[model samples]
Target chain A: MAFQIVINLIIACMWMFLNESYTFASFVAGYLWGILLLFLLNRFIPDTFYLRRVGKVIKLIFLFIRELVLSNIEIVKLVYKRQPQFEPGIFMLPLDLKSNWEITLLANLITLTPGTLSVAIAHDNSHIFIHAMHIDDIDESIRSIKDTFEKAIMEVTR
Target chain B: MIETGIDITLNISVSLFILIGTFFVLSSSLGIARFPDIYTRLHAATKASTLGISSMLIGTFLFLYAEHDIVSGKLLLAIVFILLTAPVSGHMISRAAHKSGVKPVTANRSDAYEDALQKHRKNS
Candidate 1:
């Protein structure tokens, strides 16, 4: 998956080089162009099913951005409150991620969001240890992570 | 005059981004100072800094791309690197912190590690 993304990047860069313009707009154009080309190539090629669903990837990023903004606001609000009312804890999140890469990506995504930091992974790799600052319900938190980030990752990396 | 008007608009938008970015950065610092524990502080520092710095970089990219008509590859790469690695660093820090026995300030309902340790002790 990483290799395919790198190839797409190279193709995007080559597109810009050919166009003689390195502006952001042209770079996006090139990236989309590369994606289209790769999609066509995948249709004809065997065992090259690495590249992702572009729309799903875009949706995942948008979801991440929304989470980022919303969590930032939540943290800001938490910080401004006169009384620090927090329910912070460390909990084990059981994983369904199959690969090391998928687990690492999920951990990173959890940490990158505000109010949640992934502390450790189990020695057996069955669960991830996470510290969340305002977890009203542990099940809900895990459900949201699984539904939003993990689901999107499964979609894109499939 | 028309050019000046465009410049003014660009300047205002650029300033807005910078200001908002700085505000988040400041909030993150405040969080670090005020939060109860190492893990929560790490959360604030990592997330806010990532978004804050990205916002500032976005402002810079927009200003340069709009005003000078050149998108800076270096700035773009910097933003990408920061976004990709911030979480990794946070993960490493928290992992190390936990391994080194940094306890949470007030955990309401969790002792999974302790339970695991007890189970291992009983089995052995």
Candidate 2:
């Protein structure tokens, strides 16, 4: 990750030189260009896992954004309804990913979304505690996270 | 005239983003006030407010870019910082709340932590 960031910065600088603008847009564009370039050059790199998963990463981001927007709308409705009904609960989520980075990213993504927040991780890293605002079925939420968020992350990390 | 046309479009879009962002923030505030417990309130403050501030910053970024052609890396930095720190802080706060003996209003059937704590107490 650190090496990738350095490469991204170097690409951004090169982009500044090419564009001669030295602006933020150019830098972001350059960073994206760097990512794309690295992605293309993944065959030669030793760590092919992360570079190859760029598409999955982008998909994960889009999924998060869509969920974020939908959740925001739900929260708005919840706040406006005459008698708000929130069945908030915290449940222990058994995790599949073992790495620290994967766990952290999963937790962060959960916390960022609309109704759920990741509270803590087990000492053994086997499970995470999540608090959800409208959990009708714990099994369903767990399956959803595992299928979408956790599955997407596994594509990147594993 | 052509420049004015572009300006008007930018203005409208920026305003729209701002409006959406403000709406989220307002809902979050309502959530904070109406929610019964600390855990739920944390949910409101962290998730909704983070999105709200982020959307507003996005509007600011768009306006500045449209008007001045300045790429404010600072605003991007701020957004990244908020995105990274906000959830971590929320986790810490909620963890603290739990550890300090605050209970969730409607917890599910099982708690791994409670079981672990009991076993440790029995051993000690």
Candidate 3:
């Protein structure tokens, strides 16, 4: 548990530094801010972590990159064609992972990919409603959102 | 002669990048205006702004380097940070917009997720 706390604090600092340029002094300020943000947000998120989970997190990132390239190609085709082929709709995704951080990460993945938007998470964290701009079948949309994205997230954060 | 030509090429590239950045910012704002709903607008805002900001940052960095002798390492830090942080912040914003009851443009079928969110409340 203590290990996870330290890891979480480190990640928070990493995100903070990702925006602000590095000076030793700025980093110290970021570290303190990260700690404060983490502590404040901790109430909503699960406060546990494991080493194995980190490996899955790495895998999920690779998956996201693969999806990103393919989706960009798909969007280009959609735009270039004379008629826009967007089969726009919303996907109501059921959540398997309950951690606030994990759910937020999942939302980030969806938004990072083109043609999809993370519209909302249910109050209970069991559902994440997403809007898809290029899907035809709602069931398939849900399946992809579930199997393609959420499943990866579930395995990693589990 | 080669060194001079290289410098000239770099100058052209930096100017081109700035022009492209301006285009991105224009299209994204256009998207925000033209798109019908919150979700579509979010896409326009995010995709366009990221591209714009990234290009603009790179352009500024190159300009600084070429004219001011700025080191590559420091400029690189700026580029990397923008690339990483923009998407994450964009994601967080879109999620907030979605949760605020902005319905999807479902011309025909019933949305399952909104229904599901309701169910999440019902079950618990």
Candidate 4:
């Protein structure tokens, strides 16, 4: 991804020099041209186009923000309830992520969203122990994590 | 600075964001005191505090950008750093707690981690 971005920027600068136009608009035009050129040349490249990854990253950020706000509201409601009745438990979530950074990001995202806090991970990195504030159903919590944050993370990384 | 319409809008929104941030922070503190166990407390401490600080920093970024026409990189950097580090720190704390055998207060359903540890021990 970084290589593609650098190549694109270099192409844009080359375009500007060739056109003898130094304005921001010309730079943008050159960038567009570079994008088209790169798209056409993508068959020779090893990885997918960089913009697809960028879009996925943006989507992950938005998804995280939405989850954060929704979870915060749920927490607020739980906090203010008179005589709150909820069951908190520690359960293991099986991992599908392979790399260190991806697992770390998954843990961080899980901690920052909703009622779940990542307590520990197995030595082999096969599972993460999560402490959820409200555990009405274990499978439901696991499914939610797998479907939302885990799925989004897989999209971003792999 | 004259109280122009844009200025008024900016001021109001900035203050509003700050106010919302403060509320979340306060509620998080409440959660910390009111929760039963270390693990539950971590949930409150990590999530709410992160959201609170990010919102406040975003407000500050907006205010500076609009009022002074100065793009504050430091504010934006601070927000990103907080978001990144807060969860890691929270994870570390909880991991330590678990390693130290700080059990959840009301875990009735199942503790798969403990089960896994037992299985590993038996296999070894």
DockQ per candidate = 0.59, 0.55, 0.30, 0.69
Off by over 4 Å in 1: A1-52, B117-124
Looking at model 2 chain A, report the run of 10 residues with the lowest lDDT sum: A45-54
lDDT of 4 by residue, A84-157 (tens): 77688778888999999999999888887778888788999998988877676768879988998889899988
lDDT (Cα, tens digit) per residue for candidate 2, span B18-60: 9989998999999899988898888778778777888999999
What TM-score does prediction 2 earn? 0.81
Interface CA RMSD, all predictions: 1.6, 1.9, 3.2, 1.4
TM-score of each: 0.80, 0.81, 0.61, 0.90
List, residue by residue over A1-158, the lDDT tens digit for candidate 1.
Answer: 56668878999999999999989998999889888887788756444645446677788788777887887888888777888887887777889888998898788788866577887787778888888786667788888898888898998787
Q: Report lDDT per candidate.
A: 0.81, 0.82, 0.68, 0.86
A32-54, model 2: which lDDT tens digit per residue? 89989887886776655354466
Off by over 4 Å in 4: A1-3, A19-29, A40-46, B1-3, B121-124
DockQ of 4: 0.69
Query: Candidate 1: DockQ?
Result: 0.59
Interface RMSD of 1: 1.6
- True-vs-predicted CA distance for residue B39, candidate 1, Å: 1.3
Cα lDDT of model 4 by residue, B12-114, tens digit: 9999999999999999999999978887788788888888988999899999889789999999899889989988999899878876887667657566666
Give the fraction of reference interface contacts each candidate recovers: 0.65, 0.59, 0.40, 0.80
**For model 2, what is the alpha-carbon lDDT of residue A40?**
82
Q: Please give the lDDT score at residue A147 for candidate 4.
A: 90
